[model samples]
Target: MKRILTAIVLIAIVVSLVLLGKLWMITLLAGAIAVLAALEYRTISAAMKSPVPMWWTIGAIALFFLAVFLRPQDTITAVVFSTLVLFAWNALATGVDRVLGETASGVLLLVYIAYPLTLLPQIWSLENGTALLLFLFLCVWCGDIAALYVGKNFGKRKLAPTLSPNKTWEGAIASVVAAVGFGMALIALGNWLSTNGSGYTRLHTSAPWWEYVLLAILLNIAAQFGDLLESALKRGAGVKDSGTLLPGHGGVLDRIDALLLAAPVLWFVWVVKEYFSLGSF
Candidate 1:
């Protein structure tokens, strides 16, 4: 019940934000989420006994996200520069015994959490972006639902016994199937919106159906990998949950783990499609 309620509230918040259809709103939302997730990550790091420099890590996260909106070129620079700073700080502060793990954890948080979140606003900046972002959410949502349903019912072969015992091969396949099905549903909705929505652009279907199927598989798998990755992080840190930020959801990191891996791929697909002038993503 708590999980269901949390899902509903989360969907409401996300849909409301997306309906606002403003890049700033998305950026702000993503920034807020990034900060919270970073703090949770800090908690996890501390649990592992490798604390990231709080101010430096948080400041770098904010800066990289800002680059997501202000200057695309600066985004890469921000990450590279932040990484160097983190490494140097670790070397100076923690000394040799803990420097390697500390530096690696700090840098990984930048790439793993901050970087992918930057894509949320980037996706919003593209043509038919609102729809694409919604579709991305839908894909992840449906994939998760399907994984849960199928895994609970038929999951026998352990996908990763140590990291996430609940996950299974059946769940993974179901996630892909569910994402593809959601893609087809999006195609239907796009056709409807194209006919009825004046000035409201929907994601175009210029590519063949197979292309979309492939994209769905990629996204679903990426999201699954993200879930597994987070599980690994928690397990490695010897913690069951990242934080209690969200009810029934372990933490902000737990909730957005799928997006961490999924967003970069989604952004990349949008970029490639735009670069080729291939219709709306």
Candidate 2:
């Protein structure tokens, strides 16, 4: 019941913000999520004996979002160079033993968390951006739901017993199937809305059916790997769950772990499609 309620509230918040269709609002949502997830990540890092300074980490991430909002073309280069300089400077004030781990972990936080999230607003700027973003949310959410229920009931062959004992190959396949099925559902919903002359734009995507299916498969695969990646991190850190911020959902990081990678994959696909002038997504 707690999980269901959280999912409801979360979906409401996301739908509200995405429907507002403002770049700043989307950026604001992404920024807030990034900060919360970063804090949780700091906890995990500390447990692993590589603490990232909270204020410094947050400051860097703030700059990242700012660059993404203002000079998106330059955000990648800026993020890379700024992280290097920032961490290198920090090393000067720390002992060699702790400096390496701290610096490495700090860099990982930016790449793994901050950078990918910045793509949310950029995605919102794309053609049929609202639909695209919601499609992403739907696929990921459904995939997660399918994986949990299916894995719980029928999961037997271990996917990665060493990293995440609960995960199984059966659940992983179910996640992909669920994501693809939901992707088609959203596409059908969009078509129905269009045919009825409804004002709803959140479910529509101009991409062909085949393209969307291929894209859904890719996104689901990325999400699954993302789940594994976070699991590996937690396993290495000798902890379970990133934090207790969300009841029945662990922490912000745990919830957005799939988004961390899925967002980037979606964005990359958009970029490639646009660059090739294949079709408007």
Best by lDDT: 2
lDDT of each: 0.84, 0.87
Question: What is the per-residue lDDT of model 1 for residues 1-281, given as tens digits with 9 covering 90 to 100?
Answer: 99999999999999888867578888888888998999999989989988888898779988897887888777889888888888888778777889888888888888898888888887766766766777788778899999999999999999999999999999989998999999778866775677785644545445566777777888888999999999999999898988998888779998889989988998888778779987665
lDDT string, candidate 2, 91-139, tens digits: 7877778877888888899999998899888888887888888889877
Q: What are the root-mean-square deviations of the candidates from the true structure over C-alphas?
A: 2.1, 1.6
* Worst-scoring 10-residue span by lDDT in model 1: 197-206
Model 1: residues with Cα > 4 Å off, grouped in runs? 197-199, 202-206, 274-280
Each model's TM-score?
A: 0.91, 0.95
